[model samples]
Target: NKLRVGLLFGGRSGEHEVSISSARAIAQAISSDQNAQKYELLPFYIQKDGYWLAGEIAQQVLTSGTPLQLNGSNIQLPNPSQTSLPIPTSPYLPVSSSSSSAQVADVDVWFPIIHGPNGEDGTVQGLLQLMQIPYVGSGVLGSAMGMDKIAMKMAFAQAGLPQVKYMTINRAQVWSNPCVFPKLCDQIEATLGYPCFVKPANLGSSVGIAKVRSRSELETALDNAASYDRRLIIEAGVVARELECAVLGNDNPKASVVGEITFESDFYDYETKYTAGKAGFLIPAPVPESVSSAIQEMSLQAFASVDAAGLARVDFFYVEATGEVLINEINTLPGFTATSMYPQMWEKSGVPFTELVDQLIQLALERHS
Candidate 1:
């Protein structure tokens, strides 16, 4: 009757470390929870080169504080009638050092703690869908839409929702015609104007994101962003409050208490977010009751619009001067560290962290069955 959950993390994406951190949280939290026997947190590592490291060594990686200088060269996903991606086998965790073969336990559920690019951009979700396994968060369409700011904004526009002015530029276009880059900038200047935020189309944790104030800054920002993703999006900066709400469930979802992220820097950039440790956050965002209700309502609607299931945290840009609230983005699978805002919001809303993860597993089975 127990569920064997594969907590998959540490993929080839730029957020590899973030994924590792998240996996540690899931493994520890699930293992220590009172309902531990109800589910098993199987350590599954997708190495930078896509090799599978299993058994106790994988578990050590999940629990250890030191950086892993993995000796693993690579792991292949074999096409098998019985398994999803071929079960990754490694020499370190084998029953005997003399044997190189290993067969991993069957996984009843998959918790992909990945945060960016190939991991969160629907590529992994498509594979999971093909494997006919019920995983958490959004489906392929929703995951893809949420990963790219361009497509997400397009969805907002189609839904008649307000979002900051922005445009997308492919790396191929930028490199294909260096002369055209300026022309493209000129067009953006004429259309959306200055003080833009350059963001990689499919990265998370504020990696490869820059706040640009002028044309000169835009070039450097775009180059930095292009290093992370082939598609780059530039948003005309707006002076708005950073507000976030957590959405849960599959069909009709519920929103958690609103939260505000106050950055000690100019904006919530990479340093302010994951490092620098200068930024502070406020629980139950300081907003009027009416505004809170409106935000929560809109957050649920946005989650539904994307066809998101399980969980998603919808972010919004609310400008106080204009009393305007615009949808900024939706994170289909947000940061899952136990201390992260998503888990915190639910915890404050009466669902404890372990209960939250347990509920997600139950939801996956409920939906799949």
Candidate 2:
């Protein structure tokens, strides 16, 4: 029997379009896979309105350039036990909602292709946990903590790992102590000095991030980042090269060959990341054998620190002059758009796209059972 795989995509996050792109890649990859005959891919799209719908209507909306017209309704997990919980009833005659007629999706497992908030931040994972469904990727604490830069750094620190110096700013603090942010930025200027990276504490794909070379640009850059997330993070700028490693599996995870990203900007930004004909990537980064080994070792340590499952792409900042390696960030769900680094690294290591997905599915099944 074909295993029913629900490939969930789109979300109420800044990465909605990015999620769509990921979904499209999965659609094309899985549908064309000859070995996946017994394991089907059912795309479940979560519209901007938080509606979950499958079938042709969802596909049309995904491909069409037209504005999203959600002709869809909400999707809630079905309780096979059909157990009822106590709820506030009318003072006089009690009325109950008809949940027995509720529609349910037949999914052996859920593959969340959505990124950033709402989905990747552990919100959806929590719901899935309550509903007792097996889904792909890390669990609640890992997802939530990994998604937030502040929390992730805390975990790294707890694990006795090396982390770049960073400071966090929340909206309330910024508003309450109007000078709080500027003062902290000034402190960063004094401590970490100029050319630090500013980003939303909970964003990926380098969205709403800036590299400030001077204190003058600090205020504007922070304000821009604070708009995207309630909390903003500023990391001590390391004048180094950006390298990444791909990790797979849960218990005995494996790391792939080291790769390098060369961006056209001061750092990897939104356009340099996803825009067509944008950034350039090099497989098996032209680095020495010893440095590559160290990076792979550190990548596994970081992945273990977060208790990450399924797969993640760990990024690091390497100072060539100093031979110092600093952990930049670890993405639990790095891009899987075929061209993305995670799959690319694994591909170059002899795991093609279709086989990569197959292995992930096997990992999912292995974890579930």
Which candidate gets the maximum lDDT versus the true structure?
1
Local accuracy by lDDT, each model = 0.76, 0.76
- Mark the regions of model 1 whose C-alpha exceeds 4 Å error after superposition: 72-105, 176-178
Instruction: Give the TM-score (vs. native) of candidate 2.
Output: 0.86
TM-score of each: 0.88, 0.86
Error of 1 at 116 (Å): 0.6
User: What lDDT is reached at residue 117 by model 1?
Assistant: 77
**Clashing pairs counted in every model:** 1, 1
Query: Model 1 TM-score?
Result: 0.88
Expressed as tens digits, the lDDT of each residue in 115-148 for candidate 1 is 8877788988887777688787777998998888
